[model samples]
Target chain A: MKSVEDINEKIREGSVCVVTAEEMKEIVKELGAEKAAEEVDVVTTGTFGAMCSTGVFLNFGHSDPPIRMQRVWLNDVEAYTGIAAVDAYLGATQQSEKAEDYGGAHVIEELLKGEEVELKAISKGTDCYPAKEVRTVITLEDLNFAEMVNPRNAYQRYNAATNSSDRLLRTYMGTLLPNFGNVTFAGCGEISPLNNDPEFRTIGIGTKILLCGGKGYIVGHGTQHCPGYATLMVKGSLKSMDPEFLRAAYMPGYGVTMFVGIGIPIPVLDSKMAEKLAVRDEEIKTKILDFGVQRRDRPVVREVTYAELKSGRIEINGEEVRVSPLSSVYMARKIMEELKRRIERGEFLLTFPVERLTPGKALKPMKTAIKLVKSVMSEAIVISPETSVEIAAKIMIEKGVNHLPVVENGKLVGIVTSWDVAKAVAMGKTGKVGEIMTKRVIVTYPEEAVELAAKKMEENDISALPVVDKSMRVLGIVTSEDLSKLLAR
Target chain B: MFLRLRFDSKAVRKPVISAVTLKTSALINIIKAEVGPRRGELIVEVDDSIAEKVEKAFEELGVEVLRLKEKVERNERCVHCGACISICPVEAIVLQDGRVEFLDKCVLCGNCVKVCPVKALKLPTT
Candidate 1:
């Protein structure tokens, strides 16, 4: 029984590594793009976050003061966080498996090592829905894990010729989503149906424990259970209301949050956990309300004696079992299948302590919240505004450059469009160069991430930003006109 | 299945009419799954007034009478689970010694088969 810390350390020490977009490109460059594409197989789309924010919850207990605590709440946390990450990692890894020399288990082993993967966000949200983005970097490290657990890869050699329409990677991605999501729903069940991504395995049938002996049983869909729900959240403004009135009427806990990996299923832990959590929650809340905020002492795992374990009857395979240290999104699926088998056989008697399971032991680092912002432009070409009217004409004539940025003192000061240059010449101002320059500059600092750049562009009603450094020196430029091109294969 | 009744002729004012239909062997197999096999004779006894009503309704429906019978004995037994008693549009079933006795007023529509708990009640095959 390794602790979470211990297990993480071990994984960190493993030889597997993830690959980034540049590394993948290098592989493609070495082995022709067509050949490189042939070696890898895609698994599935990774998980994604919908709403990733948290709010403070106040728990009223029997203690001295009402406990004001920070409770993480979201509609579907596990699917969005750890599971999503694994999904992304696995999907990318599967694509990497197509590498000619790398095949099957070997690829999976490599992915576990970790790779530098660049996930660029494609889009953001509208008023009705949360943000949505498509990440498009498949690395060698991701390929390793994908090939390892993939059922098809597990059964057949990478080079082995097989006839099956289900061999396509896109189909594989579809299969993984439902099954993984189902585990998040049903607690546990068989994965073979999902692994095969059978046409009929459309619904998630929960564990059916027969009180009688026969296989004749009822099937329950875990999706039917609503994990946690709240009244619609109000986000706009509450400043006008009186403080006491606001406090009484409002439950501050009603905010949208992105759920991390799957949470621990409510049933697996020791009985005292809920009680302990309840007590700790109350203590933390009291301390917070008393002095505005207080930190809780980290909890220690309580050891159970052999006698206590036997008496408690929390056993798996006839031996006492405790909460698993950390389960990957894939591992979580395996556990669910085991649970379903035990339940159907009437072997599972102990209750699950929690309703959710997290893929990793700890929450994802907050920095992961910063996803790569995508550019809107598909094509771009750089041109200088200072070029002579005739030179600009010649460049535009030959290269089809649509926009040109004006540079002064190594800083982008303005932009002159080909359209502008043509118009300036028609209006008798082209050759002067300075007269045609548009001085209203839209620029983004290199230190600022893609998301912030996008926001600033949106606010200013601009299409492109000249990338600048700390000293306002121009590095490169991004424009809506050329963004799509920059991101294209 | 059969029905045997001992009744005064005057009690059945109009000519007492009885009808029956033949069913397939598959029907029997289905019934057997739900209910036990037939045993003693099935007996039906009906009052004259209800018997006249059943005859009129069946006649108006343009259904041909299978067989007009005064009495017939067949090996069939019904554990009066009250299925037939509750199902009959008319009060036609009388229970005695855990057996069901239907009156002549039975329309013989085979509805009891549809409602039988164990499918103990069924239409007889020719």
Candidate 2:
């Protein structure tokens, strides 16, 4: 077995042999691990996907009148400025106040691409720094320092996401079609760095890596890292990185996020390392999760290998589902190749981890969620506007439902209650139910807090509210009965 | 070629797709389907050589045939991450030689268009 120092000496002398994670599989299969380890010095692995827990730290040069900024916004996207004067950390997912589809990720990409950005900051004005506000444009070259510090990235494996419910699910995993219609997953499987080194034999703090096409280092075990499942906290010089490797993704229904390109080079110190590098797509498995459930602990439908997922088909609960990749295996392969070329050309070298990554607690979610209209609402029974009062009354009695939303062409037009039917019968009115139905119906969205629905019902003296979407399509019905049941609990 | 067939209640019960495929000797691979007694929608792919023949045969069978030739216009914003590869119901996108390649098998399902984070892909109706 060779050492990292020996591999570094070979790299310096331009005598090192490097292969990408993709090519290592074939070489090891032909030569076997023992021979392949002696032939290759490093194996480059990479992955690219939408990583939300990432951001940048920027040091805007001090202005003429120094100010300790209290608030900061880059292109109308707020940046955290609680650290120091002219310093801020802009998260990748923060949305822009000025517009939709624009966010901190876009701002970061613009800077990396050498474009000027509008910077506005406000301060309370201290004696040492008297300026209360500053507004100006700055490019990447103008910043004192620009470093990308991603707290969590390069997940070892991510569960594939699918939806089993009858409605479209727009999530960070992309759009999951209703009724297990499609599957979207991340991780490049065999070529992914963490998958290659599952036990962190060479990955940990101070491990040199390529971040956005620039040299970077792993800082520590990323937040939420637990046993067997590894992640990374890495930092790189943002100013030196190439914009081609970093991109901002404006996911429809979800906010903006960044596609981070990360490449890790593992020194083939022995046959054991070579065997690990030879792991195939079929060997790496990730769970399939149902994103339809709007809870922290979404139920796992099944386990699938990346090979099965990449084949565009997988069986879920006795049904075959169409599969897709949320992570770009193509881009990940590109990064691996690029890193391999750099290593072979002596421009890049491998480094041993100064400290190994250790297991930690899993991610902790909020203990309680404020009950929403959706939580208590029941399925809505709908009726056409032309239904006769006699039929409406008969239907209410047969169905035992108090309220029925009067719909015309799939839109909520009016609401008819059992009380309306009683009044209609008492008044001996034989006209259509539309005439007696409440036209100015009170409504609440499914996402709205239950308390708001309660207040609306109490103030308006209405016992129920129809839950509708933005386009007035009826979803469900929430009533005093449901709220009272919840309150009793 | 990728095609979407709409069958009215009258035609849905007749097994139109089977008859058309038998007539043209072309196997039809369905991507997604939604059907009831009233109406039905089917997205399918056929061999490029037999695409026009299959379309005509389906239309003759009282099925509304729409040629899904609409393309995904990939701009410079695309990172070629292959996220769109898996989301394409028709498997029109694939990675070849470390690059994302778009094939003629696209059905214009639009899942990739919605899933793209950078909005690099757009399906402009032709």
Candidate 3:
């Protein structure tokens, strides 16, 4: 296997052969991985997407009298100053208190673009560094140090988000249309940095790369990074960044986040590296999670490949749903081309990581003991109005369900219970369930609180209530027995 | 040409859109449609050469057909994050070089106007 030093020597000698991950895919497909490995030196992969974990550490060098700044505000957006006297960390997603559509991400982009930022700080006033308050304007050049240390960046892959519920859902994934009308997904899959090096084979601690149009390094594995699902903790000089590759984005209903452009060049040290570079959109898989469930563990509606996702439309439960690419494919491709140019021009060189990356622990969701009606309900058994009482009795016995919602077409028309069927059998009567079903049916919605649903059942002296949607279509049945089993736990 | 057919409360029940395709050779490509019991709207594309004929047919059926672009405005305030693109039903919105481009195929569905984070897309009330 070739060493990184050998690749660097070739880069310096202006003899390196570099291509983008997109081009390398064609190369590997045309002339197998073994042959491609001997020909290509590096495969540059890139992505530009909203990475909320991005932040900047700014050292507004000690104010005239050296006020030990306790709290900091940049463009009216709060920055954490708990670490030091004049240094603060401005997170990308923090919104401005005084301005609309402005955030820490905007402040960072404005600073890099050579624009001035209004900085204000208040201190509790320590004895030695004793100016209690400070207000000043600063540019990128004015800072003693400004380093962007994003705790998480370059996700290997992320699930495409959709909403299965009837109501529109506004999420960090973007606005998901109700009833699976559209799909919104993150970064470019096959050409993304972490996707090409899924195992962190070439990407590790100290590996040099592009960060928002500047040189950056992967410091370690990102928070919540798992083995197959890799993310990076990266850092780079904020002053060296370009605004073109770093942008401020605001998702409606979801606050501000930064669009970070990252390009990592994977040195083809072996045939294994070549094979990884050949990973196609068809081979990359991402879940279609229903964002309608506002929880850490949203339900996975389906597993689809980037091939299907990028095709502009995908089938969700037999309906063709249009997919939107939230991450800029155009920008991602531009970054890949830019990185390739730098490598070919010998301006950039590959570096071996001093330490290998280790997966961070899996995420632990916030502990919420509260439950909804849906959490305690079972799938409702429904029969049409024309069903005979004899068959309804057989269904109740075979399915072990006491209550059934009588449906006409797709709508909930009436309710029938095991008692009605049994009573019909005892009376020696044979007729359709329509004659026995209750016309005025009580119903509960999916999002209704379990306590409220239970109270409705108790007050009405009913064992179960049919769950329906806005259109009165039967969703399921919530039974008092189900609540008893759940609350007993 | 793309045309939007709006059916008021009284016209909502009539099988007008289906009637257009059933009676004519001009097959409609319905890009976006939202029909309810009270009111309904449809955005469809037919042969540009026969666009006038189709619009006339819809009007004859008492449907309000609009060739509207001024109804919604994409102002200078847009951050071009393309969040509006995700919710746009007719694939009318696109992002090019960090700018949101509204294509001619827009049905004026107002979904993008509702979803713009910076309030860049706006629909002027009649």
Candidate 4:
């Protein structure tokens, strides 16, 4: 395993990122044709199924030519049919004796415009009109070198099956999805309440995510399941999608699609219970088996701005609400609606104002609090400065903790919480904490009154405060526990 | 999709030989187009000396090669466990046991063959 220091060093070195599709294309170009071909292991002949299956083959080194292809086969086809293409490609490979052989009328030079291509007829009618053969142009996507199994059949099936919705769905059915109740989102919205929660350090920015929901939420992460509403949001580059359009495109037969992200979890007896329920029947087998590992105990209901619900900006009967760092789901929804309406109307600032709390003039000093300064504090959650808000949410769930103290130069500078983590997660930031952590942290002097600390806690809605000295070193944490002890005495 | 290859006997070397022993392995030149320069061709020559040893190795590794032809009457032999699944940096494995059972996601660096437990999974012989 890479140590915290090593990971930090890599982060400091910074990464060369391709910011846009144009940039990514340019990088491929820079790699040059021969390198590109060398990098290109397999080509999929343009189908979502083919692309994904070829992706799997490329992933596993099972595909002989080592590259699945797409696009060059598309010709003038505006949109390539994702799944059907995969099936045709599979047919070609399975029946062939030559491992790297490529022969198929399946590669359609003409795109299926209004009708599905008659694959069977095409296969039978071998040679007729020949302009150019449809071949999926091959390109190599860089690898993360991460240990991920070829996704279960269901993963590709469902992701491909869903069409126009902006919200991508990843499910863990049967034993394929691990037994963890953590999910990370990358780059999307800006929600603040998520910024103050305890589980805030683990999320990263702009990275692939694994969401663990269901049983893992309740059991592993100690959270109370409140009846929170969930509203799915789908945003595309163009405003061409609507609820009905999405419904038609994605959720055709299924009443609704439940998408959750998670991580590896500690196995428990409840998983056995889920297994029993799954084995009893076939249809719900996936659900039962999935429940064994899913951490849904902690309910993270999706919430949208109230204005969207009222004005029908985004329609669906789920619920309309706002989520605030301090406000409960009920109040937060109303506030969020009004706030979002203001934002849409250009009445609000894009970012929240930063507030640094300290001792006020009227506050009294502590009886025996001494400001002994220390250079550093142990027992802290160290995260990269660039980790995004969404990834922080995942980190919280995976680490089974809520608070991640942001450190710089081996000294605590800022702090992040579960709420902040969630907000960052929802916003889809995959950057480090330095980018999201509260740069302006509230520090209480040792000479500050207990009442002042109490007020700070209440005003900031924080559970603890780092008592610091003049040198900006953390002396001690004046926590809720300490306050409670004082009250008892 | 989830079957492990095991030998009939516990001997290690014989099973290893039997596992790679294709009924009629393709010639090296044909395989070269696919495997490229880094790796050499694969040819299935019936060497009785290695067959028993191959089977023994497979058995020793606790692999049970699923005999689809004999048991299920299907000629298909390999299942896509992605011996190289965890190792690949780029997410190449797009589909398995689905449409396009194998993908060109491979780097063709011969890592999968090295990791193949049964030695049956390999690049086509040149």
Candidate 5:
């Protein structure tokens, strides 16, 4: 068994033989694990995915008067400034409160492109800090320090999701094409770090890793990490993993996710680690679930190996379903190749983890109680069905409400939403509210659970629901926006 | 006479095949062709006597004739993801030393444009 010290000595001498997890699999097959273990010094693992938990910590350097930033925004996307005076954490998924699509990821991309990003901050003037507000543009060169630290990333493997219902579902899995038309899976497949290690042998706390294009380390086991299953355990025991057996994926409509560049260097300690790296895609299995079900307990339709999923087809419930990976294999391979180059050139080195992760830790599902929604839902604004469509639209715009319950004679008769008004305007059908408002409205009771209400919204494909009582009196209104706000909190 | 023609998505599918068939009929020589998924550009040589006839033939085939001096264009949509940098066989696109530079070494191979996941690279169409 080779020791970490031995590997470091070889690296220092520039005589250490290294191969990607992909290449090592072939080498191990040709030469048994015992032979391969002695020959290969290091095995590199790579995965690229849109890791939303990622963010950059930036120290903008002190201003002339040194304003302690209370509120910070980069290109309108808010950055957490609760840290120190000028330091802030910009999360990848944090979007501009003003702009629709621009987010922290875009700001980073723009910075990498060598373009200036607008930095706006508001500070409460103090004795030491004088500036009330600062608006300026800064590029990567302007920052004193910029480092990306992600809490959870490089998941070992992921479950594939598909829609079983008749309607289309827009989720983080991308659009699950209606009726299981497509299965979307996001993972690095065989080359994945945890997939190669299986039991987290050589990777832990401080294991050096490739983050983006820079060198980083594994901080901890990622969030939602569920281990302990013999899921990817290979049979007949030849130990060596081929990164090629891993598949790269790309999720449509979800932006590029699981495409975040990640590489982990594995120190070949013995034949056991070599055997783990040799695991192939065919041997790695994942559960496929029906995300169409609104409940947290979504049913697992089938269990398929990564090989079958990567082949672009899997049988789900006896029907053929086309599968597509949301992560890019090309990018993953490129990351692996780049990491290998860095190591061979003596620019990168592997580090031991400061702490190892405990296996079999299950992530508990978050339960959203209905009481949270009731506290957030404001009083419902009622409108007369006789109100003109133009006036109803005006009320919705002025009041900043998307849904307006049309009540007559003290009973909720119909509902008019912003979408209905927009559609009316688009179709040139401006008239009375009664003519355009939806008479058959889907609703929920104040006593109903938030999950049930959210499920109803999903089933009907509506954004807003009028909360009513047993007497059919409008109590309040809950919207998709409110649920989002609840979740955001 | 020399000309450069840009083809749309439909024409890019069977670019050479369609161009060769049209070349036989129009009596124009296809000097070279570079094709990609969304678009492609071609260099053609035609006798000055039949230049107008060849141009008409390409136009009928729904190909846009670009100015001969026009080069590949990068649009505002470019996220500068650097996907094109490594794939460029000519080292035309580069991301080095904190800069993303497009060099003149570009052979217009169109490989960078195809590899761009963002669809930001645009060939000289106008």
Candidate 6:
């Protein structure tokens, strides 16, 4: 058996022959693991997917007066500045408080493009750091260190999601079309790194890898890592993380997601390792669940092989469903090819794991609690019907709210939204709230399910619904934002 | 005269050129043909004298004649992720200068539409 030292010597001499996980399978099948192990020096594994827990640590070299940033924002997107002076952690999923569309991922992308991003920070003046606030533009070059440390990434395999109910479900799986119109799954199937390795083997801590476009190393096993299933779960840290190697992605209807760069180097230590590297798409399997169910114990409708998923279609409960990958298989293949090119040019080398991951418990689902409408129904702001459209608009603008429920004499009358105001202004028919308000208002009861409220909003193409009591007294309001926040939680 | 034809399951696989040639041989000359998996558009130059006859012939063969337009529509689903920028061969789809701009250089090749992960970009068919 070739040892790690032998692999290193081969890499140094440029005598190592490498194949992708996909190609190694054929080679192993043709030549057998024993023969393939002797011939192949390294097997490269790759996966490209949205890792939400990813974030970057940036050290903006001490400012002129050097303020220890207490509050930091990049492009209006907040960054955690609690770490150190002028250092902040920007998470992928953190959305801008001012602009809902902008997120930390967008900030990362702007930095990657070499574009100047507006950096704003506020801090209480200290004797050592006199400045209280700083607003300026900075590029990646301005940072002393910009490193990405993802707590969890590169899931070995993931479950596919579909909707069994009649309403469309907005989920991390991309919008699950109603009535199983589509199935959304993530991962590169056969080309996935963990699917190839199946075990830690040479993929533990300290293993050199391709992170984004730069060289990185496996730091440790990712959080929520479960290893009993034949897949390797690991997180990698970049050496000199460059913007070119990373991508910031935004999912429509969903929030921001980070496209993590991951490449694993497998040393052919023995026949068993070689065999594991040769696993194919048909060999990898994952469970498919109906995300429509609100409870944590959502049933697994069926088990599907990656081969079936990659084919773009699958059958669940005797119904034909179209399948699309939320993660880009095309990008995954591109990463594998790029990694191969690096290895062939002798630009990348294999490194042994300094530490191995221990077995971890499986992740438990969050239990369904009280209905959201009831929970959030207590403190909703209400406006009077006699309140002028202009006044209603003012209240909405001042409160940064989209919907204003019109209540008269402690009873719900109608509702007015920012869109209604804009439309009324455009139509030159602005006056009292009663004149322009939607009288046939859609209302939800506090006792109903949050999913039902969301479905009503989606069905009526409205953003907010007033939660009312049996006597029609306005209790609270549930908006699309609230539903999205609940789902995110 | 250009025709934007949407083929049904029955007519998708049928030979269009052969059938049209046999029916209206010298009346129509196809200048550009863009065919996707389920639909096709043909920019054809019909002899002005027999244009009416050619239209009638295509209608008989169940080929739809549609009006052509030059605008590419970006639906509300566009999150402006800029995934389509790199794949545009003509640099028509660009997000470099802080905003997504669909330049006049677009050839309506639909490459951006295909690459868009959110299915946001739509090219005018007719």
Best by DockQ: 2
By TM-score, how accurate is candidate 1? 0.23
What's the number of clashes in each of the models? 63, 4, 0, 142, 29, 2
Residue by residue across A89-121, what tens digits does model 2's lDDT show?
999999999877899999999999999999999
Candidate that would win on TM-score: 2
Residue-by-residue lDDT tens digits, candidate 4, A385-417? 556666677777887666666666657688787
TM-score versus the correct structure, for each prediction: 0.23, 0.77, 0.75, 0.18, 0.63, 0.67
Please identify which of the two predictions, 5 or 6, would achieve the higher DockQ against the true structure: 6
**Candidate 3 lDDT tens digits, A1-489:** 888999999999999999999999999999999999999999999998889999999998877788988888998999998897888999999999976568998899899989999988998788888888999999999999999999999988898899987667788888888888789888788998888987777799999999888899999999879865789999999987878888877777778888899999999999998998999999989899988765567899999998887776799889888877777677788888998899889888889988888755667777877688888789999999999998998999999999999999899999889988888888886799999898888888898778878877997899999999989999899998899998688
Candidate 3: stretches off by over 4 Å: A359-361, A371-489, B3-47, B50-86, B93-102, B113-126
**Which segments of model 5 are wrong by more than 4 Å?**
A228-258, A370-489, B1-126
Considering the two chains of model 6, state its CAPRI-style docking category. incorrect
TM-score of chain B of 6: 0.45
- The positional error of residue A76 in candidate 4, measured at the CA in angstroms, is 87
Sliding window of 10 residues with minimal summed lDDT for model 1 chain A: A153-162
TM-score: model 4 vs. ground truth = 0.18
Mind giving the per-residue lDDT tens digits that candidate 1 earns over A1-489? Answer: 212233223234441122222233354446544543333211110111111121111111211221111211111111112222223212111112223222211222222233333333322333432334433343443232221111110110000011111121111111111111100011111111121111111111221111111111112211112212110111211111111111000001122111111111112122222122111111111000111001122122232222222121222224332211001223223333333443334343322112221111222333543322223322334445556776766766787665666776666667766777789778887574556778877766554456656666788877677776657666666666454554473
Worst 10 residues of 1 chain B by lDDT: B24-33
- Candidate 3 on B1-126: residue-level lDDT in tens? 778789998788888878877767688998778899999988787888888888888888889998655446777555455667767766777766545688876767788876665456777665
Q: Could you tell me the lDDT of residue A112 within candidate 1? A: 28
Please write out the lDDT profile of model 5 over residues A58-134, one tens digit for every residue.
88998977799999998898899999989998876776787544577767666655678999999988889899899
**In model 2, what is the error at residue A196, expressed in angstroms?**
1.2
DockQ of each: 0.00, 0.43, 0.36, 0.01, 0.05, 0.06
Q: Model 5: DockQ against the native?
A: 0.05
What stretches of model 6 exceed 4 Å from their correct place? A228-245, A365-489, B1-126
Sort all candidates by DockQ, best to worst: 2, 3, 6, 5, 4, 1
Window of ten residues with lowest summed lDDT in model 2 chain A: A359-368
First chain TM-score for all predictions: 0.27, 0.82, 0.79, 0.21, 0.73, 0.76
